[model samples]
Target: MLNRCIATDAGSFATQYWGRQPLLSPSGSLPRDFSDLLSGPMVDELIAERGVRAPFIRMASHGDLLARDCYLGPAGFGAEMPDQVDSAKVLAQFAAGATIVLQGLHRLWPPLIDFVREMVADIGHPAQANAYITPPTSRGFDPHYDVHDVFVLQVQGEKRWLVHEPVHQDPLTTQPWTDHRAAITERVREDAAIDRVLAPGDSLYLPRGWIHSAEALDNTSIHLTIGVAPLTVLDVVHAVVDTLATVGEFRTSLPMGIDPTDRGSMAAIATKVMAEVTDTVQHRATDISEGSATRLSQRHAQRTRPVAVRPLESLAAAEHAGFHPVEWRRGLVAHVDHHADRVVLRLPDRTITFPALCSPALDALHHGLVADATSLPGLDQDDAAVLIRRLLREAVVIPAKQPEHPTRTSRG
Candidate 1:
């Protein structure tokens, strides 16, 4: 997605100012045009014909957001509370100089979906995409900073953008720009770090808390802003805190009838608690297999959506409507737990257990290599097929390319 969004190499950007300073890419170096992902007609079709709903699309003008009820109303009688987008009303507002904001396009639009997935795969961070369509000579929002880092890609026309230095550096999600609205407005007027006219194909990277606002110039303008909410140390701390719940001292209630006004009692309790905390942290540092930080990372990986899956039509074409020629999916790992009688494979979506005898075959497949149903070494064709089929059903594996007759690659 940074194909056109950055002029310099991504490695250099990460090294110098990934989350520290502003960077601008002049564009036109892209192998292919980026505007093909969205256009005027596409926006029209989404609002007028696609029946998009609230929270997905919002309209703003002169810093005030139009309420959802203003453009959406009830439809289909007989106890059905379904709401439909009022296209005519929205179009009228747009013509009247309102800016249209398409929210969560990473989940709703196909092109952005692919882009976001690739970004997550590459950067290991959750990302979302939104597009802003502003009318000529109009500003959509008042000057403000975002709580997340954003990659601004100008797709159509031109937008005059004023980017100011951050009032609060690296603001958290809980820290809204509104918290320092006065400070931000004051700073935006004093001096700007970057004030440029972003034309089609141009792109800019702004770290969180950098105040910004834009106005369409000469003609209608559209831009895609890809927001990245990078995982922070606070997140890892939270995960660890969650695991601390298992500790006895952490779970214990405060001293019975402890006076809220008594500092003596509080200090006594705190000292005891500190010892427990210190000891627990020391142990956690020594062995982190069951620690919160490791668990949090594992949980994150388990919750990630599969980047690819067999097509519906392909499934229907396979024998018995089952996916064939499968392999382990990327961004996934099968966690194993051994029991006396069976071994369990924990997947992102589900868990499965098989007789302990199959552990060797399971380990073979878990070597981070692609394989077909016939690849299991010890099992006969029928047993291997059954095992592979069950694994596919649980989404533990995916269809693989030919030559894996089973294919293979060294575990990285």
Candidate 2:
């Protein structure tokens, strides 16, 4: 997925352009156009039939965002949802040159959902998709930067993009483009780094903090922006600090009678605390490292979701457990923690434990190698069937398919 958008391989993209610079792939350079992901008819269907609500849809005209009241109203009668998108209002706004923004399409649109999931796996970061539909000769936003890196996919028509260097490089989520408004305005007057019209099948990769803006050219333009939020060094530091909460010394109050406003007193306290923290970190290095790793992994797991599972189908599979092939759930995050007498399967939302004898089988499953009960390592036929059933019930694996012939089970 990352290769589809860039001219180079994934390794080159990471080292050369991932968060360092922008890369523009003109039309025909990409594998294909993005109409399968989104289109003008699809946009109309989302507005008129999907019952989309506020925050998911937004409108902007001439660099100013239109209020929700201008485009949202009641769903009428049975639904009665006051925030449902009013298609009539949207038409009115769009006809007047407002650009329509479909935010979080990865959660709302099926094609984008799958596309973004693959993208996340490819880029090793949390990702989301949003589509922008702008009328001919209209601009939706002023030149600005996003805190997260973005890959722009031109789905339809053409859009002239103007890209400039950042005023403040690699801004965090809390630091928005608005914080550097004066510098950004001043910087855009200079020669742009890139000024090109992106047509269908074109793509542009912009690292976080690169200033850019787009204006539709001659016709309505639709493009999908895939935003990638990469974890930073500060995130690791935060996890390490969280580990410090387990240390009693870190929980102690500040020195008594220290003047809060005195630089000398504050410096003394800071020095003492820093020394204590460094000593603790050195002595409890293993424990702190393990705790920090767990915290970071759990946080990443929470930010992503596994592929959707069908409840009724899963229940049926569980109740009728057989020697059918079972595959690991897509995007499922699992950790195998071994104990003296048991093995724990740690997931993002919960944990499951099995007897120590099941360790080999669990490890096989964790690595996505378990095919069926009989194929499970170490465990006997009956125990393997039980484990498979339990995993199916727990939504850890889904039924891939049934075997052509029923294989007779043998008692251990």
lDDT of every predicted structure (CA atoms): 0.77, 0.88
| Candidate 2 RMSD to the correct structure | 3.9
Per residue, candidate 1 scores C-alpha lDDT tens digits across 1-412 of 5545677787887888678998988765464356777888888888877767777888999999988776676555653444566788787888999998999888677888778777766667777889999999999999999988898988889999999998899999999999998898789878788989998888899988889999999899999998888787788878777778766668877767789788998888789887877788887764433667457667677545555666562353234312256656655645777788998987655688898867777777777556554567667767777777766666666666555355575432
lDDT of 2: 0.88
TM-score of each: 0.86, 0.94
Worst 10 residues of 1 by lDDT: 313-322
Error of 1 at 281 (Å): 1.3
Question: What is candidate 1's TM-score against the reference?
Answer: 0.86
Residue ranges of candidate 1 with Cα displaced over 4 Å: 2-4, 28-32, 74-82, 261-272, 286-289, 298-304, 308-323, 329-334, 338-341, 356-368, 376-378, 400-412
lDDT per residue for candidate 2 within 203-318, as digits (tens), equals 99999999999999999999999999989999999999999999887898876887999999898889988898899999999999999999999887888777777788877777
